[model samples]
Each structure stands twice: as C-alpha cells, then as structure tokens.
Target: MSAPSHTTSYYAASANDKNLRPALQGQVEADICVIGAGYTGLSTALHLAESGFKVVVLEATRIGFGASGRNGGQIVHSYSRDIDFIEKHYGDKAGAEMGKMAFEGGKIIRRFVDQYNIQCDLKDGGIFAACNGKQMRELESKKALWETHGHNNLELLSDTDIQKYVGTTRYKGALLDKSGGHFHPLNLVLGEAAALESLGGVIYEDSPVTRVEEGAKAKVHTENGSVSANFVVVAGNAYLGGLIPKLQAKTMPCGTQVITTEPLSEAQQKALLPNGQCVEDCNYLLDYFRLSGDGRLIYGGGVTYGAREPDKIESLIVPKMLKTFPELKGVKIDYAWTGNFLLTLMRLPQFGRVSNNIYYAQGYSGHGVTCSHLAGKVLSDAIQGQAERYDVFAGLPQYPFPGGRTFRIPYTAMGAWYYTLRDKLGI
Candidate 1:
C-alpha cells in the first residue's frame, strides 16, 4: 500500500508560515551530516551550526512531514513509560538520573521557544486523568514520587477539581503538572529549521539517505547526490528505512492515529475545557486531547502495528472523544490521519554509534515531541567530543524484538493486542 499522506491536521492546515526547501544535488562535504529533518535532525543542525560546525541535513520529505508535524503537540516533560519502570529496571540512582534527564527535555524546549521567539501558541498546563480507581491510585503514587524528588508545582486533584479544568466527570482524579504543556510542534520544528539556516547550515529536503557507508568518515548516498562527512547522525525516527540495519533491529514501527474537529465558538470552547489544559486518560491504550489555539478539538489515540490503514480513523476516535465530553455529540470532525512512531522493546530512546563516527538515535516511544529536542542537543554534544550527557542515554540497555526484523511487526501486534485487552478489562 502507498504510505499514508500527511494528516490534514490543524497544524498542517494552519501553519503560520510554510516554506518548501529544495532537494539535494551533486556531491557535498560537511563537518557533520545529519539525516531526517524532523525535530531531532533540525535541532542537531541548529545547535551544531551555532557551535561553528559545518552541517548538512537531509530529509526524505519536507521538514515536519512525519510525526513531528502530525502529533497532538503535547510537550509534556516526561516519557511515555512510567518512572517506576525505570527505577525497577535500573537502580534508584540510575532511575533518578534518567528522570532528571527526561525532565530536562521540557526545560530545553521552553528555553528554545523563548530564545527564538517562536510563536507556537504554547500553553503551560496539562493533566493526566484517571478513568478508574486503579489509575487514580497510580496517579497519586506518581504525585508522591514527584514530591519526594522535591519537584514542586505538581498538584493532586480529585474528580471534582478535574471537572473544573477538563469539563468532564469521566475521570476519577488527575495529576496536574504545571510544567507540562502543549504547543504547535510543527511551528517549533520549522522555527528551528529557520534558525539553523540563519546560522549557515545547509538543509536538503526530499533527499532520502539510501545508504550509509561507515568508516573513519561516513558517506551517505541519495538518488541525486551524496554527502561525505567526518560524522553522520541518523535522526530519522520511523520513516528511515534500511539506512542502518542494526539500528532497525533495535526498533519497531508502530502506527498512531489522530483527528481534529472544526473550530467551536468561544462559549463552546469554554464549556469543553475551561482552563485550556491538555488532558489524557490513564490507560495502557491511552486517549489524549486538547483544544487548538483556533478552538478546534485535537484528539489523538489508537495504535496499530500493521501497515494497513484503518477503514475510518475519525469515526474510531470521535466516540472516544464523546466518552470524554458527551456534550459535543454533534461536533464535526474536520480532519483525521495516522503517523508512525519507532518503539523499542524497553520503550526508551535508543542512542548508540553504528561505527566510530556514525551515531544514531530513535525509539522515543510516543514522547518525541520534547525528547527529540533533547536528543538533538546531546547528539550534537557527542559529535563535539563531550559525551557525558549522551552517555547517560547510550548506556541504557536495549533489546531487539525476539523475532528480529522479519517478525517484528507480528510480535509487536501481538503485544499491542494483549495491552489493548488489559486496557479493556481495566487492568
């Protein structure tokens, strides 16, 4: 089947400014060559350019054409996996270090927004809503964990308090993190792309890296051109194919779908979410939604491992929205689409060197909105010979799917079905 088109998301339709960059041509040489033009690749290019390194970035399509452009745009400061999972797998100290590293993702994103004056309609509040007693207990435990870590500004809310912000009683309780927020993810990436250009960095769109030859210097090949550089960074999340075989074994592509409703009037918007905070339910198969700056309801959920398209994505997600806000039964959905995300077995970001000079990062689960920015900075730092922060993530353990490349899709689908069943049973 042909790949799904970029979603007619509120972000894509209402982007503040859109520019089409030219594709690659002829041979080129740079100090560093980065693949993928999403958040991770653009962020790395911008930082490296600022640090006085000659940089070139190659993208398979336009910038933000992948999940970076199509996501629900929630810029939360945590990973999709829980903190307890980290503590249990690693030691307490290692868990804390990972927690701190993940938390810093939010800081880096906010700082970039402020420093660059990117107008992405950023909002500064978010809630993790609980649909059942078990989920509420989990939220409370997470609240306590944050407090124990001296991270203030995290408030525990009863169902009543949650109703004030979310305008729904479907949830039993919530954990409100003031630092967690949402923004226009596409705008964030485009602004970073512009910043990189301003610093003399080169970017070539529609130039998919077909092959990577590893050695003291790496050679990346495209149809019309090639880039030979001292260092090569692979930042393509799910769209990257066969560029690096070993890295592909360590990750599986998972599909996620999203839909957006037409703009509601001011009063209708107020009735939907009075506080304008992004909200998501607590379930293994989660539902996340938030109002766009233009008053559209941007709701995203549903994960599938198969490449086959869903018969109806908007229909699948609209009922989930109605379950949260029954008042909007007649609301019109303007757009719906799906994107792929790279998921690792451990559900952590995977970072490692393919060879001496070829570094790669992927498998951010569903948290790439902010984590990609953090990954870019760390990867850039590693290319510059400072590997402390990069090592923190690279040192983490990763396991390839049991069946390797050929069976990854089937195994991931089976695992997803099990999780979906557990979610349905409220386990």
Candidate 2:
C-alpha cells in the first residue's frame, strides 16, 4: 500500500511539527496494539504508556490526518445527541453519570497541552450563536441544562450582547462557554504522538491494519508486518474501511467542507470576531468560523452524508461565509478541503467489544474533537481493569441506521435536509 500525505488544509500548512514515523516492518509484540493515529488512538496510547503499558500504535496515514486534523477545531462539550436525549433514553442515573464526564474532554485537552507544553495555537472561549428567537430559547435551555451539570462557565448573551463577540447580524443571541475553545488541532495531535513516543510507546505511520485475527491473543496484520498483542483497540473511526465487517454497519462516514481565507487585515479581523473566540450557529447543518492565530478566517459548513467531496468546496462554502459576513465577499480562499467523520444512527458515539480482548470505539457523529480525547481516557481505563467509565458508553445501545449500509446515506441525507429546512424556518 502507498503512504498517504496529510490533506491540503490550514492545519497541515501551519502544523507546528511533523512526525515522519516509519511504517511497521516485522512482527512485533506488545501489551496493547492500537490502530489509527488520530486523537482517540494517540490519546489512549499516551495514557496507557504513562501507566507502564508497552503499547504500539499503527496509522494508515499521518497522525491527526483524519477529522482530528481537519475539523472546525471548536472544542464544544457533550455528544451530538445531547444530554437530554441520554436522560430520556437511558434513565436519570445514566444521564447524570454522562453529564459528569461531559466537560472533562476539554479539561483533558488543556492538561495535555500544559503538561507537555504542546504548541497547538491554543485559544480560549467558544460561542453558540443563535439565528432566531426559537434557537435563543434553545440556547437558554441548553445553558440551564449544562449549568445543572456543574458547568458554571456559561453565559447567555442576548441579541444586544452578542454583537460584542461576533460581527454578524444573522444571530439573535448566543451562549458563551468560556471552558469551550479552539486550537491548532494537527499540532495538538502531533504533540500527543511525540509525548507517547517519549513515554516508551512505539508508533508506526502508513501501516494500515489489513485485518485483526481475534482470539485469546489478537493479532493485528498490516501490509508489511503484524502485531500480536494481548489486547487490540480499533480507533480508525470514519476511515476504518472494511477491515472489520461488523463495524461497517454500525457507523457511516459523512463528509463536511471547510475553507480558510487569506489573512484579513487587523481591522477586518476585529470586525468579525472581536474577542477572537470560535463561533458555531445553532442550526443542524450549522456554520462554524473563527480566526486563525495569523488572522485568516477559517469557516466551515455543509455536510455530505455519503462522505462524497464537492468538486468545488470553496464555491459551496463561501456563500455561507459571506451570508454571515457579507463584507468578506472579496476575501480570497487560501485553502479548501473536506474530511469524513463517523456518524452513528442515533447521533451518539458507539462503543463495544468486537471480541472479549478486541475493543473498538467510533462513531462520534460530529463531536469528535473533544469527545475523542475523552474517549481515549475511557478506553485506557477499560484496558487497565477500570471499566466503570468505559461501561457508561458500552452500555448505551447503538443501533444500525434504519436502512443499513446500502441505503443509510440517502436516509440520513433526507433527515438532514428536513432539519436544514427547519433551521431556515427557525422552528
């Protein structure tokens, strides 16, 4: 198999450092073997390595090459399905347990950056912009709900108050979560990989796992080599492909587009985001934008349900950006790209065991940025004989899309269209 390079995007271009890790070459042994070098895998590897476990990580491409590297970089709290849904579906006790861990992902990310001194262009604060009164009410309700979970760093901004943070008239109000923020994602993941290596963990890039031979001891086979370990973790997410047939039906890959504009003048930057905080609207098919450390406007929106790329992503996204900030009609797009994120049928992440010794976690839906880091801790805990946190996710029911793999894309696409229309109508 050919080695893959990082996608052409702002994160790749501004990456603080690159890891030219060599591919797997021969048979190896470890206490644990991890597949994929994205946030979840690297986080799990780092945590376990710190716990004195001999771990090895294999990546099909570069570290953070998946959604971790290419996402909007907004580190929001909770899952895509929302805490209320969890309470209603799983009962009060389960929901409260989940809410307790909800804010920890961001904390873990901050701890990693501070502990390792990772230079990921970290920033502070994120806003949930509301486009209408209905959404504003929703934001208020969301703020209240989150506050009940002990998340106190939340502020509800009215239409008058929102303007100080964002330069857009499209939003009626906003919810400001000071704990939520943004960063240079690629650099952060790279930093984690380096930290793992420094802790005596081994990582091999461009070594895609062809298959996992499951048994008392799971053997992970790659194109050039194999790893026989007491435990195996599959963290490939949307890019896992057909390595495990059972996982394919449980998660579907969806694509989202993003574009970064040429650096704006200091005045223009202030006019757009005066506080330099990341902002994402309340719409289901939402628009998210923030200023790069260097002053470029990085905006992303629109979803392709089947993981299909638009021939001209810039054309598809620029109109949305201009609608939010019409003053940017003349801004040149410096980079445009799309990446896939795994979406479960219920919009919640799916976690379960493929075999007693073979564990997997994927389908973060659209909440991979922060949740993936949290998931790493959960996976590591489960592996280290601490199953309390992991079982919370594993116990949640994950169902296949209504129509299964063959028709799931079209089914979900129709649902997105309906919600997109509802968002437009402010319903």
Candidate 3:
C-alpha cells in the first residue's frame, strides 16, 4: 500500500507550506541516517545538517503525519515524568540536571522560530489549571521545585485570578509559566525539515524501513531502497510498530482525540482565553485547549489504550470541552481527529543504543512536543562525540512492560484507571 497523506486536521488545513519528498528508490549513503520524520528525526537531521554532516531522513508517511501534526500544539516543558519524580527515583544530582535541561526544549523551540523566521503562530505563556485544592498544592510545590532549577518566570494564580486567563470556573488555581507556550506544531516540524534541507539534508517520505543491519556502519532497509550511514537514529516513536521487537516490547501506543470548534467570534475568543494563554487542566487524564491564529478553539483529551481510536472523536471530546467551556455548547465542531502517543512502562523516555553505531530514542510517553526536539539535539551531540549531555538520558534505566507487548495494555490501563480515580476523588 502507498504511504498515507497527512491526516485531516486543523493543522493540515492551515499549514502554510507543503512538500512532496520523493520516496527512496535506490541505495543512498549519508553520515547519519534517521528513521521517522516527526520531531525527533527532523530535529536530529536539522542539527546534523547545520553541523555540516551528510544526513538523510526516512519517513513512512507525510511529514508530521503522527502526533507531531495532530497534537494540541502546547509547548510544555519537562518530560512525561516530572523532575520531582526523577529526584525521588534517580538522585538529587540527576534530578537537578534533568530540571536544568527540562526548560531547554522550550528555549530550543523559540530559537528555531526566531532564527528561521518560521511562522507557526508562536504564542507565549501557558497555564496549568488546578481543578482542586490538591492540584493547587501540587502546582505550588511545582513552582518552588522549578525555581530551584533557575526557572523564575512562574506565577501562581488564585481561583479568582485564573478567570483573568481562562474563562472557566473549573479551576481552583493556576500556574502561569511564561517560559512555556504554544505554536503551530505541524508547521514547526515542516519548517524544521525545510531548514534541514536548506542545510543539505536529504529527506525521503513514503519510505518505510523494513530492517536494520547494525555494525560500525548501519544499513537501513526500506521497501524499495536502503540507506547506509556511519550512524543510524531510529525515531519512529509511537507509530514504529514492530520494526524493532525490543522497542515494541518496551512501549505501548496510546491514542488521544482532539477537536476544533468553528472559528469563534472575537468576543468569544476573548471571553474564552482572555489573555490568550493556553490552558491545560491538572488531571491524570487532562484536557488542553488554546486559540488558533484564525480563532478556533483546539481542545483535546481522553486516552485510549492499545491504540484503539475512540469510536467518535467528537463525541469523546466535545462533552469534555463543554464541561470546561459550556458557553461553547452552541458552537459547531469543524474538525476532529485522533493520534497515538508512545507510553513507556516507566513514563520516562527510553534512550539507548542497539549497537555502538545504532542509536534510538523513543517513549516520550505523550511529552514529545518539547522533549523530542531535545532528543534530536542529544542524538546529534552523541553522534558528534559530545556525549556528556547525551549520557544524562541514555544512562537512565528503561524497562519493558511487565507483561510485554501482549498484556501491557490492560496492565497500563489499570494503572491509569487508578490515577484517574485519584484525580476524581481529589486525592
């Protein structure tokens, strides 16, 4: 079957640029060959290209076809697991390093937007809405914890004060992170691919890798062609399937749905997100929403284990959106879509090597937006012999699901249910 097109999405409808990269049909060679054209692959290819390396990226589908194109577009800091958890599980030194680097992903994003002049409707300030007192206390602790890592651009908003940002009575409080924000995610990845091409990086869309031969030089076999490179970076993340058995065992694909309401009137937009900041509620199963450049309210929530998309994306999302903004009940939904995010057993990202020359980074566990970009930089650094920072993640322990691939869904779903129950009980 031919590779699919970009999924029907608000991002696809509003994307400013599109490119049809030819499929790889013959043997090609590069200093580095990257599998997957999402954020991690594109970022790694871009960084390598900027450093004057011969880089080639292979994408099974269109650019940003996965979560990169389908996400809520929120630029949140840190990994799927918080730094506090890292401090507890790892150590204070590792925790501090993780915290220091947590905010760097947002910085990398801002730098790319400014340097390349990528027009992705970049916005500043993101709010973490607390739905209850317990969440509020967590936000308070988060503020102090982040401050310890030199992140001082945080403000705690009381229940009434949160109304100045989000037009919702659902939150008890909020944490405003000036350093975090949102943008057009699909355009950001597309722009990064363009930047990579301008630096002489090659991209092959519709090229699916079938196998990888590892050694001093890695051979990546695609359907109709192959790429031989001094190093290989496997970055397919959630959609990788079983290309690598060990990786597939270590992660599960979790699907989430999103919907875009028809462009709201200026008044409606103002009344919704008055200060124009994106808001994500504090829930184990959270809801995130923000305004589009053209004024659509892009709201997303709900996770389906085992990669089963909800029967009705809108049915699953619209009600949740209404719960937060009942005023939008009369508005029609213009678009709805679903995308899978990779979830690791440990919640922390899995970064390690298959061989000395074959490196893979996956399991962002729904925190790929920023961390994927950070992963790209880290992979590039590791390839270029600057392995200090790379070791921070590569050295962390990554374990496969307890029941392996077959039963990980039920195991994880049960765990998520427990947390969801806790969120509901305000525990």
- The per-model lDDT (C-alpha) reads 0.84, 0.91, 0.90
The deviation in Å at residue 263 for candidate 3 is 0.5
TM-score of each: 0.95, 0.98, 0.98
Worst 10 residues of 2 by lDDT: 305-314
lDDT of 2 by residue, 93-210 (tens): 8899899988889999999999999998789999999998999999999999999999998999989899999998888999999998999888899999989988999999888889
lDDT of 1 by residue, 1-427 (tens): 4433345667878887676778889999999999998988888888799899999999888788888888888867667676677889877876787777767777777887898888888999889998888888998898887766656689989989888898887988999999888988888888888878888998898788888888788899999999999999999988887777778888988888888888999998898889999988888778999998888889988887644343478667888999988988988888887888889998988888888998888989988887888888999899999998888888889898897888888887888789888767778
Q: Model 3: per-residue lDDT, tens digit, 78-134? A: 888899999999998889878878988888888888888899999998999999999
- Compute the lDDT of residue 224 as modeled in candidate 3: 96
Better of 1 and 2 by lDDT: 2
Highest lDDT: give the candidate number: 2
lDDT for residue 304 in candidate 3, whole number 0-100: 86
Report the poorest 10 consecutive residues by lDDT, candidate 1.
1-10
- List residue ranges in candidate 3 displaced over 4 A: 306-311
